[model samples]
Target: MSTRAMLFACWIVTFGMVAATVACAPAPVPVDERRPDPGTVVGSPRRLASYPALYTSTSRAERVEYSSRGPAGEPTVVSGALLVPRGEPPPDGWPIVSYAHAGDGGDPACAPSLSPDLRGALDELLGLVSRGYVVVATDYQRSSARGPHPYLDVASSSANLVDAARAAVASVPGASNRWFAVGVSQGGHAAWAANERATDSELRLLGSVSLAPQLDMTDVATDAARGSLSPERVVLFPTLVDGASSTDPSVVPDNLYRGTLSRRTDAAAPCLGDSGAVGTDDARAVPAADYAPATDEDRVRLTAALDARRLPRSPATAPALVAFGGRDSVTSPERTRAAVRAACARGDRVTVLERPDDDHRVGISPEVLDWITALRSGATPRPTCGPEPTSPTSTGPE
Candidate 1:
């Protein structure tokens, strides 16, 4: 794994929230019964627990625990927030944006649905929604489910996001079919996954915008074993392992935390920063080499799972705009550039946004806002590829 992958796995330190979670054994959820469409809402959307949403004084806010399913065919209830712009619709109704959030590790409280200040962590959503777009973000399954969240379970995260948008269209007044996605960090990965999968769903996804996404899990895991993982990162290992194992049980047939990093893993249950309460000494104590998967079976499973998580698959049907900080410690900018090249090689209509001065929290810049506007207006965004002094297309205000 490159330095960025190590930084990416350890990006949990970037978030400013408390962690709270309990380990859960990987279990088989019932096969997700097929709906008419992958993004179909499971049942009636309940508006009882609505929170103070963006535009509430102007628009409206509501928290709904909607019924949605996973790609595996298991039935589940996912929590999320939906905000509709106040005032009259624009004839055809409001153009919607399915917002995917950054990965906040395993803490359920950090999930936007349960967040006390929903608009703060994701101020970007407020920016877009205030401009007349209906925004919906999912809290993901593991946060509210019986088990640990499968951090990068591509199918589940993608499903959670797509269904949230689908629910918005059904429950929000004047919502249109012209929907797209914008996500950062873990969410950036989900946005990309949704784009790959959305074409087959009932919803019409025009495109997606991803910022500093967690693209290569293999790179991340490799660095962890090298003992290169930071103190903040080591604490997050359990969730990554647990999530991956849940997605592919063969990866860790046995309990991963029953051994050395037990308390550190347990401490990771809550949000970031505080996750260190379990201490950084344990992470420093054992070298990643010592705990390398011993058996051939373990090696095979690890290899396969990593291969599955690499980004830039071929034949993408929609437009994608991806951005990452030039010096991002979390996920490498080089990886983003590589994915851009791979996407181009695969016939994907993609664009690259490189920020020389940014880091893990890639604030949505002005260039990004303009890119979104261009996409909304049907203008093909130009790819600012190639190395050198190209900076984030947009930053802060115009």
Candidate 2:
């Protein structure tokens, strides 16, 4: 071949190699389930009880198996426990508080059913029950069962939570229909989503209390890339992104699951245990920025899906009591404010509280206590530093 011809051949070979690499790479997953549509319904709510505890210990915690009509189900079963104070059986059925938890390693093997630690969180659940409130908690659809737990599939997740609350009221002995929702991190995200999507008529949702909710995955991912986030969050972000992207067709499976991303892919399997074990290395190897989508189309679609799957829209219908740690490095307070503002604009009542000294985990209890106090008084809870001055204010008079 002549020199020019040889050069041309080399260029073709290089192009082929690059194309092959691209073709083999995995793309992000898109959501396959229908996004939440808008509508509101009010219906007569009923209550019944069933057994959810297999172990004697769980049985002692006021645990019950409850069901509700949700999405496409005969009845979705959720496990919940009522923690009413020693003597008070809760007058007028007591108010219901539902909790949506953060990612629980997404493995069925390591589900709350199997993990001692998760079961321990039940202590908190039972604590709320003890406070003369019906406490409803869901393992979320995918995480509880050994199936695809759509990590951020807000609609389905919210549906499961709402159904679980309905079940808890009927299943728990002294429970009533007056309800509120609360969650931390992943659970907070679920609570937020459920609040937005819940049918107004189905359940009398008073308000939602969220602690350190992971409202913006993209923002969290960006912070993780900058080394400003925790190691656990860095690891968790990709798993969520991958899980959420799995429903989209434009996202190539291989590209979505390739390289460092694949290391944490197994984290979504719902096997009961520490997901950190499987994803530790991947967490260490990649930076958050590197994990973001490269193309504009990919970014746009991923962001749209994330926004669509978020729970901000529900703030309009119910009052929201949201708290975040000022020192929170995992889920930024600024982003949380943005989400709160969006929800408020939709006509939902919202309150955003910030604890300047708290980190992701420690600052939650105080907020919860404050929320309980506000709800009991029948007054809207106010944000600590006043309204997020940069964001929108609550429509309910300050």
| Structural similarity to truth (TM-score) of each candidate | 0.78, 0.69
Q: What TM-score number comes out for model 2?
A: 0.69
lDDT of 2: 0.53
- Roughly what TM-score does model 1 have, to 2 decimal places? 0.78
Best-fitting candidate, measured by TM-score?
A: 1
lDDT of 1 by residue, 312-352 (tens): 66455577888888877667677777778887777676777
Off by over 4 Å in 2: 1-88, 143-147, 200-202, 220-230, 267-282, 287-297, 382-398
Model 2: per-residue Cα lDDT over 214-270, one tens digit each = 887665434433445465565565556645654544543333223555544442332
**lDDT (C-alpha, whole model) for all candidates:** 0.63, 0.53
lDDT of 1 at 102: 68
C-alpha lDDT of residue 326 in model 2: 84
